[model samples]
Target chain A: MAVRAVVRRSFYQDSMVLMSVAARLRGQPGVREAAALMGTPANHALLAAAGLASPEVKGAAPGDLVLVVDAESEAAAAAALEAAGAMLEERSRASGVLRRPRTLEAALAARPDANLAVISVPGAYAALEARTALRGGLHVFLFSDNVSLADEVELKRLAAARGLLCMGPDCGTAYLGGIGLGFANVVPRGRIGCVAASGTGLQAVVSQLAALGEGISHGIGVGGRDLSAEVGGTMTTLALAALARDPRTEAIVVISKPPSAAALPALESAIRATGKPVVVCCLGAASSGAPGTWVSTLDDAADAAAALLRGVSWSPRAFSDPDSVRARLAALGPARGTIRGLYTGGTLAHEARLLLEPLLGATGHRILDLGADEFTVGRPHPMLDPDARAAQVREAARDRDVGVVLLDVVLGRGTHPNPAGVVARAVRDARETAARAGRGLLAVASVVGTDADPQGRRHQVEELRAAGVEVLPSNAQAARFVALALRPELALALLGPR
Target chain B: MTLDAGLDQPLRVVNVGLELFAEQIEAQGAAVDRVDWRPPAGGPDIASLLARLED
Candidate 1:
């Protein structure tokens, strides 16, 4: 094996372009790992930690662009580097005739009427740009990560004071009015607005809302830590205020991985002030004690929000249909082994773990949030590259202890074009492998998308079902389905046939 | 005074980094100005730069 590095001197490019170029290189023959990153100190540290930092990569200037490939041979390394160069050129060239400015000040100068600044720079510099935009009277959509909590607090404070929205530092999705920002899905425009601390959680809820014939008016991403003890739900509070004032939103959904104990009061108070029907899906927390209807899963949050909008009485159920659960278990022969959840959405993965642990107690299950930093080191998120997680589904077939394979397909703008097809092919391959071993591999999945999504939610669901994968109605249902399959005794008790 | 006031107006954006974001907004008929952002000229004294920007 060999390592090679190329530093494009002082040539900066967007992280998405770099990630795509790197993804292309990873697909190249004999390439072990590929990273295309700007030459910043933080990136340098990441390369060093990953053992990919050559002296050249380490010595790169912050303004430089670094492309590194770890490959099978010297020839392979060099070839991948050349490929990276070409991919970067092709992608960066896609920038159209829009005037490009070097500084935010210059950008605002040209378009003084610009009310928003979408910042996706490296984390070391994300706060700086976000602050600049806020000071210049632009609501910020910060799509960068690795920003310090201190910086996030300061930036949110400034935005709050100026009555502006600062969407994220690690925030990945938001839809303001009809415009999709960051990695958002093509959801239907309707009356429900969302303020999310989890991007994919927001996606799951909004997509499910659309599935329920209720759509979002606006989806505000408050990064993943807006409700942390340190941040004190500053942005979430601000977003709540904004959503309250918006006439288009008749109801609201707020999603997070449960707020910090200290942050919950203020957050709940903000929700109360919205004077709107709110459904809170703060995963892992039983009840936020807020005025809004508190739910455990993103699916329930959407359901509750839809019901609120309809002025009908509603509460979450174990399964939307209980008869189907019993039928699914009976067909699978109540196979009981280790449950493996291979997921692309981090929040979805978290939900799976939350659902499975109570059921699989004493016994075991493995849930991999493949979108975590460990899995997505130099590569794009598994959302953008479905083949990675899809390929993992096949690995389950080889392991006899693997009882059921759980998966999630997230359909959105910044995601893979045909994630369902990719997973469907892998499910077939895994099933074949399992069949060869005279074993049954129960593949369960949830598609987080709406009919209006670019990938066509209904079509994606059909694709998964066609491959013999039990396409559960929601991520919560899919995870719970694995639990019921592994312990069929639990199914009769948890979800009785109607 | 809040985001609602701006939501009614056609979204005008100054997008820094990722031309694709600008393109996505444009595809939805919103106006976006792209910034070919680089680290500020003297490389980056990140902490100091953040302090200056905040001020």
Candidate 2:
């Protein structure tokens, strides 16, 4: 195999665009691995670590954009590079507009009444832009990543002092006044407001709420690291204050894993101060009650919020229907004991781990978050790329001790247009790979979306089911089903019928 | 003083970074303008800039 690199000077594209372009290159025959990134220092490091950096890439200026391809042969490498160039050119022409402004000052000058600034630059520059935006009297929706913790702290502090919202440095999703941003779903305007530290977690809950004929007034994304000890949930506290005072939001939902000890007290207090009913889904946090409702999962968080607004009682949904669990276990016969979970959503994966560890033992289950840094250093998120998880599916199928391969398919705006279809092909192939070896691999999966999402939940589930995957109702249910496949006795005892 | 004070108002935005963000805002039927923003000279050093802007 050979490697090739293409460098374009003085060009730029956001991370997701480059990731999508690279995904296209990987789909080409003979392409082994591909990455399309700007020539920033961190991106340079990512390329070097991935073994895709060449002399040209090593010498590239931060203004340059780079595309690297590792292919089966010189001709294939050349073809992939040519295809990548065409993709970039097509993208540029597609956005063909007149001369655009190049600074925040110019933008505000053009539109003096502008109150919000959505920042989506490289991480090295994100904090700087956010600072400028905040100084210019704009609330910031920071959509970049790789920002230092110190930068996040300073930016959030500055925004708070100015009485403005600074949504994210890695904030993936938010909805304001019915406007969706960065992988958000389509939900109607209603009374419940949401503040979340996890992107897909927000999507899962809001989509569920929409499914239950409920809607959200606002959805604030505090970047994934907001609740860390250093950040101390500064933005979360501020967001809670903002949502609490918003008259349109009669109920509120806060979704995240249990926050740092230093941040939780203040966070809980802020929630209580809202004076409105609150639904807290701090997964892994001990269940709590009173002025607020505590939910163990994202689905229950939505239910709690809906119940608060509708004046109904709330209860957590069972992981799965008992009859279905028994039927699945009976179908598995005498299978291998290990379960492999490949997840694109980190919190969902963490939740599955929390559910499975006590039953299967931590080492017994392999629940991999493909969106984690180790897995996504230079690649697109599994939600967008699907290649990494697909490869893992094959790996799981090949493992002699693995009988069940679990998955979570998240669909919405800014995600792959057809994530289930992309994954379905791999699911079928992995089952075939296992069957050829005279072994059985049960693919258990769940869809985190609603019928209202761009990729309809019904269709995505149908596609996965057609590929022979057991499509369960939720991620927790999927994990429980995998547990049942591994150890029926333990699964029956722990996850009895609801 | 409260975000509620502004919740009933029509959305107006100054998207200083990505065009997709502005596009999404417009798609939502709100008014938005894009700012082709880049890192300031001296590369994201906002201490002095923030001091000057706030003052």
Candidate 3:
């Protein structure tokens, strides 16, 4: 007679409750199994009880009470059960039980102010979750990466019909309402808002802005691969439009790591139409000019953003000026036949290609996208994926054509076993191999993340630089430096005539 | 029963029942806060009560 009345809700409605219950039941002694069902559908209850057929007992409705009991002492158990039941009844009467929200109708009835729905289910189930969220009149933040482009397009279209913001299918970082969502920095609230096509790049700017004592109204990360030739800038366009109308935002900072040329014009035009001041930071771009300000480095982007936030007017500095760059390049000694561009992020490779492509021309084929499918293979992140690319760097050092090998080392939370160790070993091995080949190999690299990262970016960059690889603040800067070393003439044009 | 003198320390009590608990505890010269509670399948247990009490 010791009755246990378990209240169940839909996974969509009461996930925390369901998960907590499952966890508790796993530890409980008397409870052999526990299942949370959406409804008292014969199939659902049967599935919950390990597919055992339920007896012809009364079935419970949505918020109805059902008691199940198994106790040795019937009288005591019944009395205890009744007491528990009475307590539950009293609690229910005092504060009504929330019915399991089945349809979009039910979900909306519960959380009317819920503007955004974040779907984090498996890839196959993501589309349904998104559809449900959209139908519930919620803006969908699709956290599920690797969703097909077709599915994304449909979801985006649906979101537009309801006049809602559909953030991303693989959107990693966002700062909404002065709160960090996903991998984001906690900058204070200010007039400057961002809609970036990169996560770490966006984070760098946000952190730097915070350091400068400037706040951010919002930092919307529009995924790294958004501006590629294939995807175009669907979300970027919508985000720009929304931020333009946002009263909190007085200025906008658009950041990207050198998107394809085809994608640039449309994005540029959108910014121009916004009328609000914009600070553009397309990493690896030699020069950029809009109706607003242009910045080169990630640090410069943050500085520009902070200045904008403070309503302080500022102009862009020419970091990639040719003559200045050539002077610096010429000042350095003879060609260290081998140089390593060690980078943490993937875009560093694309940035390196831009800088080196002009100098090395076609021979820049040595540029390896470490995070690319070919290199990383089954691994998660290129920098986090150990030994495979590290070994490649070792081999590259032995190649006679390989004069300078660039390494991009990105530091952030959740990056595998300290990146310093990986780069340190790679640099050590590469330098050793280059020396044996009777060629000097200079390891020129950059640390992508900031002090906000627990791995200690400053220390890691120092470690790599101390190990003989030149460490720059960003992957793009490192690539620029490598390009300067390779073709001093191009460097002269970029920095100004020496 | 007499109140535990140790309860003189700053304490936070979370009640799952309703605001009535808050009123009752306050009547007893103790502080209790009411919060939304959606207990799992097995319903409210000792651990949950402890968690609520801690909250």
**Model 1, range A24-83, lDDT digits (tens) per residue?**
899999999888887766688888899887877777877788888889999999998888
Candidate 2, residues A264-340: lDDT per residue as tens digits?
78887898799988888888887554347888888788877888788888777655367776776677664575788
Interface root mean square deviation per prediction: 2.2, 2.9, 18.3
- DockQ: the better of candidates 2 and 3: 2
* Candidate closer to the true structure by DockQ (higher is better), 1 or 3: 1
Q: Estimate each model's TM-score.
A: 0.88, 0.88, 0.59
User: Per-candidate DockQ versus the true complex?
Assistant: 0.61, 0.45, 0.02
- Residues A1-498, candidate 3: write the lDDT tens digits: 233333323222222233333334333444444433323344245444653334422344323323333444455434444544454446546644443343333555565554544443334345555665676665555544556777677766676666655666656556655545444443467777898776666766776676677667777766665666555666676677777877788888888866577677767778888889888888776445645577766767877777766678766443534444445556665464534444434444555666566666664356665544344221234443555568877887887767777776655433444777777788788889888878877667766555656576678877886777766555556666776676655544556544
Q: Given candidate 1, what's the lDDT at residue A489?
A: 74
Among the numbered candidates, top lDDT falls to 1
TM-score of chain A of each: 0.88, 0.90, 0.64
After the best TM-score superposition of candidate 1, give how far the Cα of residue A404 lies from its true spot, in angstroms: 2.2
Give the Å error, residue A263, model 3.
7.1
